[model samples]
Target: MLCFRFCPVPRLELVLLCLVLGAARSCALELNLTNSEKATCLYAKWQMNFTIHYETTNKTYKTATISDHDNVTYNGSICDDDHNVSKIAVQFGSGFSWIVNFTKQEPNYFIDSISFSYNTEDNITFPGAKDKGIVTVHYSEKVSIPLNDIFRCSSLLTYEENHVVQHYWDVLVQAFVQNGTVSRKEFLCTKDKGSTTVAPIIHTTVPSPTTTPTPKEKPQVGNYSVSNGNTTCLLATMGLQLNITQDKIASVININPNSTGFTGSCQPQTAQLRLNSSIIKYLDFVFAVKNENRFYLKEVNASIYLANGSVFSIANNNLSYWDAPLGSSYMCNKEQTLSVSGTFQINTFNLKVQPFNVTEGKYSTAQECSLDDDTILIPIIVGAGLSGLIIVIVIAYLIGRRKSYAGYQTL
Candidate 1:
């Protein structure tokens, strides 16, 4: 037996609660729909990547990314009897939902639009935007059609309102299938055939002061990627560190994305990657292409919540690090530090990134960072010095062996 009880909450709240409850029961990463004949099948699998830039109370910019499905609590689908239209809703995180509407015309099914709903009450995620109330990022344009096989798109969809909330979406979806099952062919959206470029490197954070550091422990390298279909568009591998001042005491934070949430978005001209945790509210790195041929890290935005209940914000846009050609990556095997702001410093070790024109799911060519030029020259200089020393030693030895014996009278 099922029991029902009515709460006295506001109508809007009640509706939202019901929707959430429904999603909790049906939330799933994959959705399967069958026609009345039961012989035809429609399958949909999507990986959604969202980049949100919001404002704080002090008029500072803050960014957040929602790409991890671990927080997804609800998923539901509705289709008409004739299967002409289908709607799917996925709710994740706190007060956030994505609704996708699909329409089928004859032999093809097309995505009509996608609507993103976010609640401003979640101060932890939308801190200063509390006064904005409910916000929606909608894309009404029709993407492509013919979902019979695999349909994929990774284009950056930008939506902004009042310069307060800016949303960039990178969606990879495959819906509407008449084949018996999903095909095993490699994804053709990009040159890659998988979602990741290399085996992701997982690094644990450094132990606390009281704990002894392990001798074999290496610094964590954050491997972040944004993919659509089987092709990864943005890939970055680097060890991230944050230097900040707390209570006038300087401290360093080694960002270990292995134990935190990491998300990003990829586009042709620009890309973004963000790391989020309780201690570090959000660390966002933005990359952009310039002069249509070169690409570089354009800026970094962050909001740090300290242990002393104080908040530190970083909004630095005057940065141009790790520059390379559009078809190549930037490599820096040595540690590179940038003063993101007067009070905040960012450090990256063994950094390699390719944000545009990636090929075969890997970096095409590498352009060494200018900062690493000296590092590249150290080996050459040392080798030259060693050769010179060896020649001198050989000459000295020959001279000594060939010298006249001063003490030998028989010579």
Candidate 2:
């Protein structure tokens, strides 16, 4: 039993309490009791979602309902905290409806009467209403009477608005009173008997809902390491080939005229080589706090060496529109790969995408043996040859002069 302290309310508290709450609101739970006749103690742990606006915090019922457990007895000294207790929101014989938690009020209040009432209407509305059937109040408020009436409480607080129905529902909290303080507090709630939905009017019979499973992420392309003998088919499709060992720089992978396997729509074996290297490098490449578009390489400024020792760089070497191929393109999918515009090309030459440092996208260049300004060998050789030729001509000229003089003397 519980005793409630009664006192005069300073405000004109009537009609719907929520109507005067301005922007705030309240509600009561729709309960369905296993045993309505028996006065069994109910325990409930309800969850609510709160919306904080600048100063005020308003709470709303979530999709989940109160987890009701059996046999939770009243606990405390009556009205000790005065945190619980609300006005009669609904009228007597008010059928199944939404429950509401009235905003906490001051002063004090007592329970004059705690009873359950039920009434069924058959206006072609209430579900399972077979020409107005008997729908007993399965769930309702159960206010505990004080074991020891310390206040000698009599003029019980007016059942102001407990019967008034709301669109939502909330748990009802009533406390067992002592002299002035609350000794024990117990929670009560109306069970949802008919539908999972909360409404002013009882909704129709709702079927159990089916849950949807979350989707799994697609696996990114991966790599494999092998020798040339193992990949006879790969060599046929790809014009050029590159191989990189994990963590170690096995060899500088160069793009050549033949690396066209990646230029077509991603087939199982179509783009396998490029797929393998890029994926393996991505795993090894680490940019802890990097964005997808963050630059790895500013400019690919290096001469590429082909298999036959032919060296060349990208003709124009455009970096303005260079997109860091960091993450997989959105069009690239696992099940059915998309057809791309192939690779960069001019005339019949298909441009090769050189293997880059996964993080830096750095490319390597081959040093062609062009004329060097550092060496003086060419100048030295030319100077020696010209001096020798000049000396030979001078000797021949002197010999001719000697021969003419000798001929004159002989005459």
TM per candidate comes to 0.41, 0.17
Checking candidate 1 for backbone clashes, the offending pairs are 23-74, 27-75
Error of 2 at 300 (Å): 54
User: lDDT of candidate 2 vs native?
Assistant: 0.25
* TM-score, model 1 to reference: 0.41
Q: Write model 1 residue lDDT over 352-392, tens digit each, in one string.
A: 98887777788777988777777868888999999999999
How much is the lDDT of residue 119 in candidate 1? 75
lDDT of each structure? 0.60, 0.25
What is the alpha-carbon lDDT of model 1 when measured against the actual structure? Answer: 0.60
User: Which residue runs of candidate 2 sit more than 4 Å off their true CA positions?
Assistant: 1-16, 19-118, 124-128, 137-172, 182-411
Shift in Å, residue 258, candidate 1:
1.6
Please list the Cα RMSD from the true structure of every candidate, rounded to 1 decimal place: 16.8, 29.4
